[model samples]
Target: MMPHQPSQWICAGRFPPPYDGQSLLTQELLELLSPEFSFIRADATARPPEGRIYAPGRLRLRRIPEMFRYIHHLRWLTTRYPLPILYAIFSGNPLGHIRDCVTFAWAIPRRRPVVVWTHNALLSLHASPLWHRTLHWLTRRATLFVFAGRSLYEPLRDILPEEQIAIIPNLVRRALLCSQTEVERKLAHADVSSRLRLLFVGHMLPEKGGWQLLEAAFLLRRHGVPFQLTYVGGWVTSHDASAFTRRIAELGLSRQIVHHGSIRDPETLRQLYLSHHLFLLPTKHPTEAQPTSILEALNAGCAVIGTPHATLPEIIQPGVNGFLVLQHPREIAEAIAHYWHNPNLWYSHARAARQLFVERFHPDRIRQQWIELLRRVQQSIPELAQVTT
Candidate 1:
């Protein structure tokens, strides 16, 4: 990273504590870029339209009135540093997407180097005509669009300039925060043959493959493979959670299947990841960007078993770090059984997973990428370099 490059950037997005992928990425960039770049945190709460636009608690007509505040902040950044840019972040949510789009649209002309950092696939998702047009408008105006992964940028090939897009991947943070030696100490002597400790850390939506894990559990039980699958995170629908509870009862496998509800605390979540031998995310959720859970699993030195989708294929190399199985019970069952049969396999994979995290998603690598991208964006606008120099 260019520590001496007089660049002041603003990272505007949802930061951590909500304990999700998007928020975690925002937080990672915010902290990683702090030392080198003069960064301002524009914590625009992209809450859903409270009632209606400008109504009792709506988005207040694009928050356009707040332009004075943004301009003031920009002036302050320029005075304090050299090159001032806005790294506005966005996601797949329709309401938040529109809000960010509008905010960037207004800020683009005024702000020297503005980047729209997207954490998910945009072109693939469905949106209303109005929101769709607004997004396209923002895309045109944005100095650059940063995607979480290259696969995410594939669909936007035609619409967005190739030069304007970059992928830094959803890097891991909690893994680095924890004591690496302590985390690997448990894995080094873990007995994967005896009752396997499996983890599923994602929303309890059907698309997340919560039921498929249950089916795999049944098969593993029938095969006499001792294993425990714990489902973490909250349910999307109350009906689904209730139905899942009943399904566990009907199958008489409540004892084997554990649900920790939603784990928000990072330390607690880190410990949970450390205790488990395998992390399972059998999700076919189409909107799945680079999942932060898989990265967390790797960082915690846990082998992964996720379905082939999104960033899973990129990271979960078959028989390497984790198994990217087809979205089915049989595939998942076979994978669980494989690890149970060969305990040594877990050690090798655990090593590989941690190595992958350190090499690809480490903070040092992420920091350099952010610095380069920021520099690239600043260079695109001739005035930014002149002003900073």
Candidate 2:
């Protein structure tokens, strides 16, 4: 008897250049699932023009060529494979959705199964009613829709069947997980007398709460809290960077806070996470979903402090792994002060955070979910079902 061959999938989505949560998660799926499956890469990464930064969300005329390149590749890849499962990220905006609708139009006619990954929840809230109805019509073309969290299903709940929707939380890289020895050493050296180290890892944009975090730091300083806040990301632009610097100086948080720019090296980032006692992301970004930074912090045994936005409330348990605060500076400061007064409480929360990561976002757990979801998808197709069985 011959062994069964791995199923071929045309996995199309954003791969890293800019390295945001969605792009990283897409990369994670491709790398981690390669053993059981084969993939034909259709890179949807919107490469920026020469000497320009790649920003996918911004509306620019230059992106038209990039979109055409992706569409052309996707069409060619689909033709090469025999009934390949079309796994791609479902865009949240009308322009992107229209592009997707056109690119995957071939699959729709042939009744090929497409797995749509939903990483953002902004389309339902921010899009116009006409676009919403259009998105609803376009979304039905997919055989299945995967969501990052349970709360994220609300946007397409009314339009999609219950069986078509599957909840799968995003997983962070395993390298980010600290060793038992490292965790022990970190906790041992972290004495109540020492300064509490707080870390924030994301773009230094106002919407991402960089400014709000600085304001909270000022409030903490006024209350005489002993802490060091490190910002581990680059500003969106030189102008934003300049504005941030001016604001930091004006708030007199230059001494208490520091920006380390963007650290891409995994080992260095892992080390930073291990050294910090708290991870702060008071983001009010409209398109926020399940952020990988929160999971990274959880893996390193650092208690998270974030707003109850998107799928955050599900990820954070108040007084357990972390605290969910309002998007206001005062509330963020209060959450920080909660840990300042009780170092032991912070330690307990840190342990709980690590435990939550182990139980919830472990690589094995995430892999199993993907395998099951893929198996179900394969079972739906007659030819693929025969090959699997």
Candidate 3:
């Protein structure tokens, strides 16, 4: 066992066994940081661990009750720990926003250093001016503000001091990197004789461009281009599922498209990446901070194609590691055809993509950055060191 550092940290965030980005990130942080820190996790949607329950699921009864319970819990935890820092990984839900505000306000009185992990692009969200003001106020009071992408860092740098804002991009494990020789061997055996294998790995929401990707696939088929497309994630909403299914049928793409619904296991996800030749995600949402799917694909050595939205441009260099396209389906189809004509482009780009992942987005490399940020927060709060040790 690794020697535990004397500092104790209570991680308040959304955590698995629920499959979402926030949950995955929280779990990853716990796994990487627990060896050095005495960590306790408090999940929003999960049952409390044994001996940590402040109350039952009574918070689900009403909004006011939930608010009350949240405040009570925040006060109790801070009072009990009285530690130097409280790191919160918050989503953009209304309830969560309020809870974060309350917790930050309470922490301020105790002089506890607070760190807020932002997964969403807050300024891009269609929030009311009042809500924006509240967010600004809360962020100004935080000891450190951590962003998953540089795009987010630009907008928030002025709100917090330069040193207080940390840009730690999401990462993929090193084991996911497959050798080019291995990828080629698997492709040869898969019998993809006539068609290029294109994979889309995200939810079926409109913002994720499910409709756009499906349309591009149809256009490719119409142009007599030989390619197969597979989608490998669940629907975001009921309406999204209905619309996606209707579009797939209307376009007569049943023969060219395979919809492989949610695959959660890490091993299975890596296998999907290895089996596919290209990964496409033309997400239209400007508020999207960063998508882990892109990193996972790069780690698996797949040639990537996505829109130049949010942090995508920071990750993908056009015509280098991958191609970035406009929102038009025709443009996407054209890019696909270009790659089909020059298969070596895919090999070269895939190699570059994997090299980039190893250089910056590897889990072990990024985890050190996170530890350094936590240590800075500790230094800012001298009282926390006394309580935690």
Where does model 2 exceed 4 Å of error? 1-5, 49-56, 106-110, 122-127, 386-389
Give the per-residue lDDT digits (tens) of candidate 2, residues 1-389. Answer: 22445776777788877656677778877788878876777877875433234343567787788878887887776665554554656676556666766776743334667788777674443357767666666667778888889877775567777888898888888667677678768777886445778899987767788788888888888888888899987655778878888988999888888888877678999999998999999887777778889988888889999998888898899999889998788899899888879888888998899888889988779989988898888987788677544
Candidate 3 residue pairs that clash? 84-384
* Candidate number achieving the greatest lDDT relative to the actual structure: 2
Question: lDDT (0-100) at residue 311 of candidate 1?
Answer: 71
Q: Model 1: what TM-score? A: 0.82
TM-score of each: 0.82, 0.93, 0.86
Q: Which candidate has the highest TM-score of all?
A: 2
lDDT of 3 at 101: 77
RMSD of 3: 5.2
Q: Would you list the clashing residue pairs of candidate 1?
A: none
Total clashing residue pairs per candidate?
0, 0, 1
Deviation in angstroms for 325 in model 2?
0.7
Total backbone collisions, model 2:
0
Candidate 3 per-residue lDDT over residues 227-298, each given as its tens digit? 889888766445666777888899998888888776667777788898887889999764577888899888
Note each model's CA RMSD in angstroms.
5.5, 2.9, 5.2
| True-structure lDDT of candidate 2 | 0.78
